[model samples]
Target: MSVEAWTTVLVILSFIVYIYIGWRSRVSDTKGFFVAEQGVPAVANGAATAADWMSAASFISMAGLISFLGYDGSIYLIGWTGGYVLLALLLAPYLRKFGKYTVPDFVGDRYYSNVARSVAVVAAIFVSMTYVAGQMRGVGIVFSRFLQVDVSTGVVIGMVIVAFFAILGGMKGITWTQVAQYCVLIVAYLIPAFAISMLLTGIFVPQLGFTFGDIVEKLNAVQVDLGFAEYSQPFANKSMLDVLFITIALMVGTAGLPHVIVRFYTVPNVRAARYSAGWALLFIAILYTTAPAIASFARYNLIDSLHNKTVAEVQQLDWATKWENTGLLQFEDKNGDGRFQLTPEEASNEIIVDRDIIVLANPEVAQLAPWVVALVAAGGLAAALSTASGLLLVISSSIAHDVYYRMVNPHASEAKRLMVGRVMVGFAIAIAGYFGINPPGFVAQVVAFAFGLAAASFFPVIILGIFDKRTNKEGAIAGMITGLAFTIFYIVGVKFAGMPTWFFNVSAEGIGTVGMILNFVVTLVVSRLTPPPPADIQALVEELRDPTHHVPIALTDIGEEQLD
Candidate 1:
């Protein structure tokens, strides 16, 4: 089959499989919709968790970012993956033991305040929306290429498919479908990487080939010849502070994300939660390790194809000509010279390459089979669709369970709540589709904001709620307010006002590191000043500290007893 035909077949096959899983696993009750009735096995949940966590950012953007950034990209690999360690050890099992449906449930009951739960809900909504927008945008990008349609049309198509699964099946449906997505995406990602690896170095392993091949050395020599720095050099273009704090923000932020944390809630028990985290990390590490290898291979091939070639000659190259039509790769005869030379000087090269296109374009750059290119298109969509479905569930559950049932109508029936949750899923997906049509920025940039916000608003408060028994409602509320408000202010200031100077030279992406520290300080100071939480709430904390015991009933009842 032709490339277009193969792309159509692969994408349709993956979608049919996912839709079938969603239909088979559809949930009727609130418990099943919200947390899969806590019946998922550890290994299955782990695979689902890996799919949920590896959004378009990991699947499509990480390799592209690394292709351009060189060793500085290690911050993303380390920061993104390291946070799973924190989640597995510090938070996942304990939260699972708490036996609540949502993160807000823990916050509200732990602090013995509805106001705190409401705050967490708002934060969850914000974090999930920000994250989902990027996922939808990624979906649109892949679909635009796969279906040969416009991005806006692709986004609409993607939104409809997501709504079908997320609105009907909820978490149970999403979980099983995501397990299938993990298989599709991971296999799709690995094949092209292994093919490119073998082609470049006569080795099947991309990671080993990346380090062992003479290709990198040759690329480095080309960089020197072109007056640009070596591609393998550390911190080639970024500041040390940018790398340091961004890594920290992303690491802690991963632990704070609502969708990812909620994955732990699907496991059968506290022990399963812990085991699931380990398995999830192991699965994620497979792609995380291979991404750099693909990045290196693509980077080398891209530079090799362009260096010493004239603009006219470059226009004739199949990969360059193909991507140029998409506006992701552009060339101009600046300085009136036809030759292309990628030097440090802006005018040295005639090409302007969009970093986002690296992975999608990698197969073509390597002159791989057309079918491999089609598979890559399908893989990118799987990554985006899986994560988008998970985030949509988080957004809907926060509104239906946390806001409606928990806060507004405590007497609401499970059926009514499930309907409301489904409605909210449809509503949220529409909003995300809107953003995808008119994206605020690239997929990775929007995701960075999501991480920064989650790190600032949730990470410190959740840690304190678990570890600090004396941490009261007032302190937790004050901390979230400070963190959320200040982080948004910093992001707005840097992005809109062009505020050039930041505290300690931290970039906008790394400002969450600072926001987290301030949250901890404000929380501590406020907790010391306020009266301690009631005896019952304090006792509940003690109960949560031991993960060996599972609390099947609602924690809200425990909080209400103190009030009564």
Candidate 2:
């Protein structure tokens, strides 16, 4: 079969499998809808969480970013991988022990205030919406190339598939489908990586391929000859301070992502959540370790196949022509030289390729078989849809459970809540689809914005709420509003409004670190000015910290104390 034919077959099979799983795992009650009744096994939950966390950014864009930025792209690798450690050690177990349906549930009960909960709900929506937009754009990119459709049509198709499963099965459906997606995405990812690695470096292991075969030296030499910085050199684009800030923002942002935090709630207990976190890190490492190798290989091939080639020769290449149709890759004979140029200067450069397409186009550029190309399309879809489904759940659960049930009408029935949750999913999908069709930036850049938003809005309050016994409702409310608002204003001004990067020259991508600092400082200062939390909330915080099974409050003469 041709590449498109094979891609059509594989993509259809994957979608059918996803829909069948969603039907089989359909839920009736709100508990089943929200947290899968807390019945997921540790290993299974780990796979689901891995799929959830490794969105389009990790699978399609991370390596692509590396291909384009070369060594400067390690920030994504370092910050994203290091974040799992924070999630496992600092957040997952404690939040799991709280035994809530969502992150806002914990914030609401811990701070003893609906206002705090409302702020968290809004933050969740903003972060999830921002994050899901990237995933939807990824889906559109895949369909645009593989299915030969307009990106807008592809976005609509993705919205339909995701809404069906997410609305039907909720958390229960999304979890199992994600497990299947993990298997599909990992296998699809590793196969091409192994093939390309062996072809380029004569090594089976991609990590060894990039390290032992002198591929980096060759790429560096090629890049330098083309008026670009050596591919292996660091600080080619972003400064050292900007790198540090972006790295911290992504790290804290990963740990605070509301969708990922909710994964621990699907497990049985704190122990299970811990096990799930450990397993997820292991699964995620398999891909993270292989990305740099693929990036190096892809960059070398792209330059080798196109640099100084005639316009007619490049136009005859099917892969290059198709990507151009999506407006992602283009070629022009600048200066009427009848040949393409790969120089760094924008005026003379005749080839324009979006970094987001590097990974998807790698196999085609290398002239791999049609099946390999098709499998990559399937994998890309799985990665995007898995994360999109999870984020949609977060948005729906925030509105239906956190705002509607908990605050608006505690007396709402289980069926009504479930209906409302499904309705919210439809609404969220509509919004996500719109963003998909009209994305603010490429996949990785847009996802970075989401992480920065999460870092600013949720990380400080969540950590403080867990560890600080005296963190009152006023402090939590103030911290969340200040953090989210400050981060959003900076992002909009710098990215959309052309505002100067006047704050220590930190780019909008790294401004979340500053917002996080402000959140912590404002929270502490406000907490000190206000009265402390009630005794019950304080006792709960102490109990959560206690290692024993039970810790009761004891009266110690003048002041109340915790009995460990």
Candidate 3:
């Protein structure tokens, strides 16, 4: 069969496997839908968490970004992984111990205010949507290339597939399906890297290939010869503070992400949550550490193929012609020298290398087999779909459980709530599809914005709620609002409105770090000025702190339905 045919077959089989798993694991109750009945084992939950964390950004676009950005891309590595540590040590165990269905459940009950809950729900929905939109776009990109369809059609297909698994099985279906996805994606990602590694350095391991052979030195030599900076040097031309702040922002944002943090709630107990985090990091590190090797390999191959070659010669290369059709790679001889120059000024053709194409095109670029290329298509979809389903669940559950059931229809039955959650999943997918069809920016940039928003809005209040008993409703609400407003304004002004610069020259991606400080300061001052939380709520916080204490009923059960 042809490459496209093989790709289609592999992709179809993957969807079938996921749909089957989801069908078998279907849930009927609100608890099952939202938290998978809290029965997931630590190891499985860890795998699911890894799937949830390694989204399209990590799988498809990250290597591309690293390929181009070189040292600057290290921020994504450090920031995202570091955030998992923060989550394990500071947030996950406590939140899991608190045992609410959603993040808003904690915020509302802790503050003893519906208004506080509403704020958290809004924040959750907003952050999840932002994150999911990027995932949907990722789905579209992968499907479009493999299925030979328009991006919009690919997005619609993605929506239907996600709705099938997400609405059908809820958390139970998604979690197990994610385990399968993790296996598919990790294997798919590693194979191409390993293939390229052996070709270049005769090394079996891509991670070891980086330092084991002459590949790194050759890659850097080629890059410098091409008039670009050395690929191995850290802090090449970028500002140190900018890199530092972006890393910090991403770390906090990773911890603050509702969808990722929600995974811990699916595990059985606080111990599972902690252990799951460790396993998650181990799984993620496999890809996280290997990505740089792939990036360097891809960069080396790309430059080697094009440099000192004529336009006609380049056009003859199958990979070059294939990518040029997508408009992601182009060639023009401006000086009519007939040869492609690596330097920017002399190079006639504008090589608008869309950062996303790096990973998806890596197999073709490295001249790998058709099967490896097909596997990449499947892997990309798995990465995007798994993350999308998880985020959609978070958005839907927050709306149904936190907003509608908790506030509007407190008398709603468990069955009714479960149905509402499923419907909301479909609704959320539609909205995410709209954004996918019409992305505001690149997938990574848009996702980074979501991270910043999450960092600014939820991180401060959540940490304080756990660690500071004196923080009252007024303080939490004020902090969330202040943090969200500043972060949003800075992002909008800089990204959309053409604001020249922000405080400390921090980019929009890192501005959340500044917003976090504002949130902390406002929350501290306001908490001191306001009355402390009621005695009962304060005692509840105290109990949550004591790891030995038996978890209260509120933490373990679906909250009692309140009357209107």
Clashes of each: 0, 0, 1
Q: Give the Cα-based TM-score of candidate 3 against the true structure.
A: 0.96
Residues 373-440, candidate 2, lDDT per residue (tens digit)?
Answer: 99988989999999999999999999999999988887999999999999999999999999989998
The stretch of ten residues in a row with the least summed lDDT in candidate 2 is 555-564
Candidate 1 residues lying further than 4 Å off, grouped into runs, are: 547-553, 559-564
Q: Which tens-of-lDDT digit does each residue in 307-424 have in candidate 1?
A: 6688678878765776676666777767776686666677565678877778888988898898999989888988999999999999998999988997799899888999999999
Candidate order by lDDT, decreasing, is 2, 3, 1
Task: Specify the highest-lDDT model's number.
Answer: 2
Per-prediction TM-score: 0.96, 0.97, 0.96
Q: What is the lDDT of residue 305 in candidate 2?
A: 93
- Which candidate's TM-score is highest? 2
Q: Using TM-score as the measure, name the better of candidate 2 and candidate 3.
A: 2
Global lDDT scores for all candidate models: 0.86, 0.90, 0.87
Give the higher-TM-score candidate: 1 or 2.
2
* Model 3 steric clash total: 1
